[model samples]
Target: MADLTMARLHEAMTVLYAISLVFYFIDYLNKDAKAHRIAFWLVSIVWVMQSVFLGLYITETHRFPILSLFEGIYFYAWLLVTISILLHCLYRVDLPVFFLNVIGFIFISIHTFAPNQIAQSPVGDSLISELLIIHITFAILSYVAFSLSFVFSTLYLILYNVLKKKKWTKQWTRLPSLDQAQKGMSSALLTGIPFLLISLILGLQWGFASFDHFSIFDAKIIGSFISLLIYCLILFGYRKGKLHTTMYAWTQVYAFLIIIINFFLGSRLSSFHFWN
Candidate 1:
């Protein structure tokens, strides 16, 4: 019964976030401070409710709530919202906050509606030690950051084309400037790469310690190295001015696709590292 109530609360939180997203969109389009203020308060309320839900789960389980795919998604969405709130409070970045929350709402909605995904049992701490848990957590966070970078990069490409054609839209106006978008993309990559590297190192250590027949040639392992190399190349190309802006952005998009494939397909096909 308590679990059901928590699930309902999470659903309600998603609904509230959706409502807040609409208000933020309106504020973005119409420059309405009142609407923006309302959206801010709505987000805060949802965050508070989510915190309580997470706290209850942690209190009951004596563990973090990110031991399952569903819980990881929920926690990722929570992190996005937390960042959104911080950006709003610190920088007053209204449109970015709106965009971030849009993504957050999508993630939370998936968690709310996907019963099969949520029904999967969480991996216990007994099965996976603390180092493995940390590795997985950081890896997931790095992927989330990379995902956001991809979004920003996509926006940058779209706006670049719009500018080249000398066409402007209201939506274009609401988006960050091309330079800002590029910076955002770069910043996310910079933040994610270190986490990804650390996670890889820790994951390797955990795998070797936990498995009797761990191999570096596993599908997931190879995919991780590929992803890391591709991102590094993209960053290098960007820094060296070897890749054009649009090209760099497109590279990020493709790299993100590879990440998606590796995460969903490669992980499943791997002989080891199949956490899902």
Candidate 2:
């Protein structure tokens, strides 16, 4: 019975995300204020509902679902959606909603379609529940924030590059000025920094305590650190006034690519912080 309800909620969440994504695209393309507002509202409601569902899930299982990659992906998507909501509200920028919707749709869609690949029911053991939540809460939050920022970075890069080459002026110009896009990406980075720090700190603590300090030196950790450095460097550029919106945007896109490679870094490489 609980399984059925959880499955239904997941389905509902996916559909809601898809609907929100469609409306956001419409808002982006048509520049319709009504559609934009509707899209934003939908994202906000759906995100809050997702949090409620997660709470229900943990209550039912009495455990955190941070044991597997698919579960991690689900949690990551949740964090991204939440941060996307918070960041968009803070910035009040159109482009953030547009790209975040698109990226959220992709993340949700892949997981929805590959259900068998992602879901795993770990034993609800007592020993790990508290520690599990502690680990997963930070784990998903940080990586997911980085993941969303990567998407924003990608958009900034593409938009900036297109403008530089003068490729799609009339269409792209309607999207957002490069300056607005740049600001939006920077905003995402700025907001994401703290989450990443928390994640990294908790992860290190867990590693040192468990395995008798036998931490796995994996690719994800190295890649994530590299990603952290890349963004930091970009931020430094901003501080020095050398990272123009467009250039900063370009770095974000590259940063996203680097992050994607890091996904496999967790699975394949040996230095990943959370190589599960």
Clashing residue pairs in all predictions, respectively, total 0, 10
Best candidate, lDDT? 1
Provide the overall lDDT of each model, using Cα atoms, as 2-decimal numbers.
0.82, 0.66
TM-score of 1: 0.90
lDDT of 2 by residue, 1-276 (tens): 976876777788788777877877786677677987788888888788778877876787666667666666666677677767876788665665566666666776666667583454332332353554576566566556666566666666777678788788444644556566666567768766666666666666665665565553546656666767887887888889998765666677777677667765555555333333
RMSD of each: 2.2, 3.8
Candidate 1: stretches off by over 4 Å: 116-122, 169-171
Clashing pairs in 2: 153-252, 153-253, 217-270, 217-271, 218-270, 218-271, 218-272, 219-271, 219-272, 221-272
Sliding window of 10 residues with minimal summed lDDT for model 2: 120-129
- lDDT agreement of model 1 with the native: 0.82
Worst 10 residues of 1 by lDDT: 117-126
